[model samples]
Target: MSEFKQLSRSVQGLSVLVTGAASGMGRATARVFADEGAHVAVTDVSADGAKLVADEIGASGATARAWALDVGDASAIDRVVGEVAAHFGGLDIIVNNAGISVRVAIDDPAYEDAWARGIAVMLTAHPRIIRAALPYLRKSPCPRIVNIASTEALGATALHSPYSAAKGGVTSLTRSLAVELGREGITVNCICPGPIRTAITERIPEEHKIIYAKRRTALGRYGDPEEVAHMTLSLCLPAASFLTGAVIPVDGGLMARNA
Candidate 1:
């Protein structure tokens, strides 16, 4: 009889770096990973917010550290990824969740700036980070990458061309890298969240949010950041080895409806 090869479901003791982790989905993803015993690098443009999340996790007896990172800066991506790997011994997973929301018309003067900024932070940062972390990730038995795309990648709304374009790029990047990295045992996946209750959506009026949720989502509500984070966690698991190139929707059925 052939012996069974067991795979691990736990992320305990693994090193994880989460970008834009100062608040919203990034914060939730860091916390979830820390709670499960991973050493988390909570990095964000807002240093104070990242520290707060790291401190909160430390207070709970979990492992975490904070770093100020601007994903749009290519040099910063290399520096921070290296520092996080040094601090945690090695990096096994990277969650490219940093983002900016750009809502501008195509003819608007600000549209060009919005598009450039959106692409820099969201689409471009993914490969830069993964490239920086490749050396360390290669040393690990399980290496994973999770890129946070959006439902807007699958469908779109008016006035969000820049944001949608960047997200669409992320999904494509996820697939291309998944194929390229598969031979190395590095799993790359994407999560397309829909109507998530994050800082970006917080500005919308409560009534308007509720109305939109009811009209658009199948579940009739917005999803919490932790809900999206959990899916990110699942994809990084060693047990999910065969799940590369998957563009999963953690959208509470947002993409499942047509009417």
Candidate 2:
């Protein structure tokens, strides 16, 4: 067999679970893994959206299943992890890509509640899900965990204090987990994305969009979801075995500019 073909077969039969796989970067990441021959568990808060993505993968002759997941709920996280692992025989990879961004100023009346929820889902859920999946991950010869953080984790931005704090926590968590799990043969890493063109960004006002498009990234354009997905796929490969505790950015030179 050709070398590329042989390498492509490496992930075959390996099971992957991507949270928030219904749309955006999560969906793109799930699709990339499935396309590369992994049996993927596509999960999201939106059952219909998750099922649709799963069905699409299955239709394309890949193994995939849809599951409802509300990452902020501890019990729901536990239940989904257990069920997906059981169905897949054991979990080999986990992508903690589920997150929400609430952009309210600290002085706003709704700030406290929004901040709490954002932290719960974006920061707290990462470790919770990892702890639940540890047993299953321990069984795999090449286990991996990819936490989806944001560029906000690296710096401050107006109207995004809560999200920044939560993602910063995620980055810290990724580093700690990588060290703790290294000896167990599991590699944990974080991907910090910036200004990706996703459903979330579509809500920005047109004038704000133009300004962000021009100034936020060095590339002077927003990135595509698939671009982030490809970066994610790179980290999941066997060739990335030496990489862990790494806080890599998929931003279009945004973080670099900040540096």
Candidate 3:
């Protein structure tokens, strides 16, 4: 029994929906899910980028598709959730990886504006997806929902108020939902990553990036896309089924340091 458990592909033949699938952690996660024999539907604001990933998955003979979606719109989220569920018969997993970042100081007057925009995409949109998919997820034997967050959920960022606040909401929402949905067989958890190289992080001033590399992380290095992708797969598996409402940090020992 233990050997069979060790060799089992927990996600094989499951249908997965991954947001922000055009690039960064989301893209990496989508590919990883497909590699594990899950049919994946990739969604992002970038149609071209999402289509490119879908095409790659298709070329590998995996079931995949892409949709251009603005996570800010609840109706749009509902539409895509319904579409994916209908396409795949039922949605066994939902990876809420779509998010937006805004660079603004905490003391800035425009912080409210920046924070609102970030919330629209990062924090607000995820519930729309869960609400829309609850029916389909309830039908599945094993249901998983993974929300991608950031180290900013724990550490403060002077120049990233909006991004930090949004991610903080994600961390909170994960715990809240876990308590509410645990008995229903839907597992909810958040992965708070630190200093991942992505399109959004490239905009960070190099000097500041290096400073971040030096200060926050003990390893003094940024994590790779694959590392975060592995975390995503781990969260949705049956082993993690009993692990709900936990904030799993995949950062390279960043949370351990007092400095």
Candidate 4:
């Protein structure tokens, strides 16, 4: 077989599970994978949103299904993963992209609950989902895992301590799991996005957006969700088989500013 053909086969007809696939980066990532001919399992806390995306994919003649998945719930994670894997025969790729951002200051009254919830959904859920999907992932010839971290993992910003900490934990977990799963032919990596224009950031005040565009990102503007989705898709291809334990920044040269 030609080298190009071999590389193209990597993404075709594989079973992929994308968490938080209702909107933003998750929705974009799931759509990209399905467009590339993968059977996509669209999951999110919002059942209606999940069904919408899944129905959209199904309209394109691909095998897609929506499942209600609250990553913070352990039993829901296990059950949804098992059902998706069985439905697809086995799972090949898993993207832990489900996250919530709460910007409560450390001294705020609601800080405790916000902190705990952020960690539970972002940091803790990655490993739990991975564990639940391992059996099916192991059965695939090309098993891959991508954790959606953020630029906050590499640096800190005020009023987002919990989010920053959880992302940092995700980066660490990605590296550790890559090492542990290497022997199993399962590659793991994480992507740190700088500032993507999504529903999550739509609430940022215009002044803050202006400042971020001027100084924080080298690109001088926010990125599209599809930009991040493209990088995520590349990491799942056979060409990226040798790439693992990598903390790649999809952050428009933000990380490169100092490095």
Candidate 5:
């Protein structure tokens, strides 16, 4: 294998499927997996962006493919999982990284939509992806699932209660899935990212941006999406066979101190 392919194939020859793979953490994680020797399928709601990521992976000499999906739809998740598995022979890793941000104040009627949409994408849809991938993942010698969560789930953040609540559900699901799948050789874990400098955080108002940049944040600034992605890959790799049900926070120590 070429150097790029050598780095891309961790767990020997397993396949990984990452949702929201068009950009940010999803795109970064997909690249990391490709470097580690795994054939990676990148999925996103953005068809063009997904195609771009697939192209980048393929250029590196890794097997790559793309699918545009609306994760909230169970049938869509099922169809995509099947497609990725069919492309790569089977599924061994899944990263539930796609999520929508909801920002609404008390007086805003949009709060209701934000709450509902946030939950649908962040919490409800993840298990549906796992359910669809389970049969194939179970067949792998090393099966793993990584759910992208948020530090908001652990601590109170003004104006983001709904988003935090949705991530809290993700945190819970990680533990539950781990216990259920551990016997079958699948490990499940979560990454609680701090306010990462994704498009979502870039849009935050300058005034309140500091609310997420308090002394509690040891890193002193918002984390880059790839930084969070690197943390994610560590947990999802097949060499991490002994780790499961872990909630590893990539928050720059935001959760280590009292607010």
Candidate 6:
């Protein structure tokens, strides 16, 4: 029999950075990784919220730390990424899950501002974070970058041009970087979450949410944040080495439905 080679499916002892981890999918992602034995950096613009998540993870006997990070601030991004790498001693994976809702007509006076902020947080921050973490990530056995896009990147909704544009950019960036970093064994992937319950969607009327899910999703129900988080985790596994540049939709089959 040929010798069997071993590959790792675990992320234990790996250092992972999850942006916008105070609430929603980001928070769920952090918890999932911590549960799996990875050292999680729960960062968000909301310092208290970030601390709360880290505290919760610590209380669960998992490894985690909180950092006040505003993804839109370039200087802060550099500083925080450096601090996270320094504090953790090494960084392996980055989940760019920070995002904002920017709903405005192209003709609106605030359209430009909305577009700039949305792009800065959702699209631009991905590259900045990746670049900053490259030194550490390059030194790790498994270097993974997961950029959290949205189904809006594939299908757009009215009044969400900025959000859609940024997400689209993220998907593109993921593909381009995956190709560019392939030779180095670094995996870059994008996830487009369809209709997950998050802080952004909290204000939607429950009846409307149900109606939309029934009409638009194959599963006829909204997905949970952990569902998406698990997908993120799967891509970061060292055994997933062959998979890269893939844009996955964790929307309960929303993208599979057509009416």
Prediction 2 global C-alpha lDDT: 0.90
Superior candidate under TM-score, 2 versus 4: 4
Model 2 per-residue lDDT at 36: 90
Candidate 4 — which pairs collide?
Answer: none
Off by over 4 Å in 1: 1-5
Better of 3 and 4 by lDDT: 4
Model 6's alpha-carbon lDDT is: 0.96
lDDT of 6 by residue, 1-259 (tens): 9999799999999999999999999999999999999999999999999999999999999999999999999999999999999999999999999999889999999999999999999999999999999999899999999999999999999999999999999999999999999999999999999999999999999999999999999999888999999999999999999999999999988888777
Pitting candidate 4 against candidate 6, the one with the higher TM-score is: 6
Instruction: Give the 10-residue window scoring lowest on summed lDDT in candidate 2.
Output: 1-10
C-alpha TM-scores of all predictions: 0.98, 0.93, 0.92, 0.95, 0.90, 0.98
Q: Model 1: how far is 200 from its true place, Å?
A: 0.3
Candidate 2, residue 25: the lDDT equals 94
Q: List the residue pairs that clash in candidate 6.
A: none
lDDT of 3 by residue, 1-259 (tens): 4555553447889999999999999999999999989999999999999999999999998889998888888888889889999898899999999987688877888978888889999999988889998999999888999999998998876787788888999999999999999999899989999888888888878888778888878888788888999988998886776779989888878898788
Model 6 C-alpha RMSD vs. true structure (Å) is 1.0
Evaluation by TM-score, superior candidate among 1 and 2: 1
Off by over 4 Å in 6: 1-4
Per-residue lDDT for 119-208 in model 4, tens only? 999999999999999999888988999999999999898999999999999999999999999998899999999888888998998789
What tens-digit string does per-residue lDDT give for candidate 5 at 1-259?
Answer: 6565332225546798999999888899898888878888999999999999999989989878999998988889989999889888999889999988777785788888888888888899899999999999879877889999998888867888788899999999999989988888899999999878776776788656566676568766678888987877788665687889999889888887565
Give one digit per residue, the lDDT tens place, for model 2 in 171-210.
9999998999999889999999988878889787767866
Question: Mind sharing the TM-score for model 1?
Answer: 0.98
Candidate number that wins on lDDT, 1 or 5: 1
- The reply for model 2, stretches above 4 Å from the true place, is 1-9, 205-210
Report how far residue 83 has shifted in candidate 4, in Å: 0.3
